[model samples]
Target chain A: MQHTDNFQEITHHHDYDREASRKEVIRVTVILTVITLVELALGFWLMSIHQELMRHFIKGLICIFMLAKAFYIVGYFMHLKHELRNMIMTIVVPLLLFVWFIIAFLADGNSYKNLRNKYDPHHVEESKTKVDKPVHGEEHGAKKEGAIE
Target chain B: MAQAVPAEQKWWSGGKSPFNVEYGKLMMWYFLMSDAFTFGAFLISYGTIRFSSNNWPDPNEVFQSFPGLGSGYPLAFVSLMTFILIISSVTMVLAVQAGHAMDKKSVIKYLIWTIIGGLAFLSCQAWEWTHLHHEGAWWGSNPFLNMDGTKASTNFTNFFFTITGFHGFHVFSGVIINIIMLIMTINDVFERRGHYLMIEKAGLYWHFVDLVWVFVFTCFYLI
Candidate 1:
């Protein structure tokens, strides 16, 4: 077979270890499945608890599990872990921006909620009121008068 | 071209790839990174809206329906969807590995499995959206009340449909890319080129889809 120089340039020739790579893939798959199962179990457990603090804690735990799953998918499945360190850094460093992005947005949202509650008592009051029958899209015309009041 | 003179190699001396990967693969990685930011913005906006609201509907109460089994199974159907994507990702990994080994039969087998999984996940999503729409949930309508039985804002359904719809579009496109790759493989395009690098790039995309679903599941369903 004639091997072209263009082919060599376009593809990296790395040493392929069939047995080792297969074993690693299987290990990562198992780890990902177990993490997902644990996350599902926590989610189910969360439904039974009503305490605000407990719910928050479990949600936090679920978030951690979610991150773990992300790690495995990117690291093992995407083969980023096997890439050069420079390549990995380039992909990862930019993602750090999400930290500030999430913090600023969520903090502002909380502040907006507090400000609205303090100034617009009607909005606060309206959100808390319970409807005897939940309104559907089809019933919007019929309930227009009631909804206005 | 081998000159055994230097002790330390210059990785960035401008003759070799600095990252030791092909430019196409590197470009794919960057594209996926940008796509990640797009999703991150959507989810963060969702969290912002949820936090600013006086009360939010519990996802369990909202997504508590499984086809054929009726409603009341909270988090069950979505969990099934999650596993389906994960398993598909595993198949994608296998397909890429097969491509590396130049095993045409194994590559075709795993690619077919991955496509089937993608279609099944899309079907589940279609059923879900239909069921929710029947219950008066749409872009600007929400029939489900908050955990405290209080009225809910339209933002809940808005984000729900928008984010999941966007994600569904990704899955659809990913499947398309995989299908194209399968055809190319069948036609011996990569076999003639003597490398399966194209399949590797597609696998990266497929795995990225699964990664995004992880966060979406946790935020929308689990939490």
Candidate 2:
């Protein structure tokens, strides 16, 4: 806590007051632990039961709790709560785009799956009409003839 | 009489760190934020494939194996891992606190505890990976199959390995960094500077690692 050193002289502008930060840390720790416990309880309960009512919202509930834990870690442990508004927004606003990316990809991938399942249950044949001469190469010709036997 | 410099002339027209944090701490936060998006991309992709598939492996059934007790306790082991990482975060906070108070002794003490917690979590992961590999799950195999005989296991196993393995690497690096911090504290490196911002930076990283695990746990195990 002494300002004898030059580094301390420059950056030691604040007193050694960590009491508030310390208390917040402990509180956040307790909160995170409690939230995790609730998630675990819900996890096991839902795992044991197949109630349609619970199933309707279980994924949403799990996600909500997960976000809560994420916020606590970022806001308190990482000390973004005490940071400048500009800084917070700088980090946060850009992340929204990431969420958008997930949604977009999900839509695109599902569309592809639908198309594949609907149009092609199996591989498509290259020819619409039987070839008069035969389409198989010599190796395929021998294998095809052998398979027919 | 000297003229004042133009507004744009100063490297930082400077009020404080743009985030009002130490330059190093702010940089650390930015680094963590970037790292987060990388993890975000991974988990989000995993979720996409999982939901798209007709039948996905039940995480509860998949992760039931526990050490010294084979395959009965669903999530019992990962819950322990979560607790350990959270506890390590707490210790890391205390270490940062001790650093601010210039209590180097307590800082080192708490850091050692943090490192121990990290090691314990890593050991659990190592065991989990080994067990899963033995149980016919690996990068190339996805033992879970959907009705039409299409194996959903391939994407599941591959994503599981890549995502969790990436996370495991972060935890490994975090432990190594914590060890370095511990060494510096013991050697009075921060003591000479008279501030513990170094510990705080390391704490941000360690907490970020835990935070990422929270999502990984939800995506991989809880869901």
Give the CAPRI rating of model 1: acceptable
Best by lDDT: 1
Tens digit per residue, CA lDDT, model 1, B100-157: 8889989999999999999999999999999998887877667777889887767888
Best by TM-score: 1
Every model's TM-score: 0.93, 0.83
What are the per-residue Cα lDDT tens digits for candidate 2 across A70-142?
9999888776776656667878898888879888877866676566556765512211212232222332212
Off by over 4 Å in 1: A1-14, A133-149, B1-7
- Model 2 CA deviation exceeding 4 Å by range: A1-16, A51-53, A122-149, B1-12, B15-18, B145-151
DockQ of 1: 0.46
lDDT of 1 by residue, A50-79 (tens): 999999999999999988999889988998
**Between which residue pairs do clashes occur in model 2?**
B142-B153
lDDT of predicted model 1 = 0.86
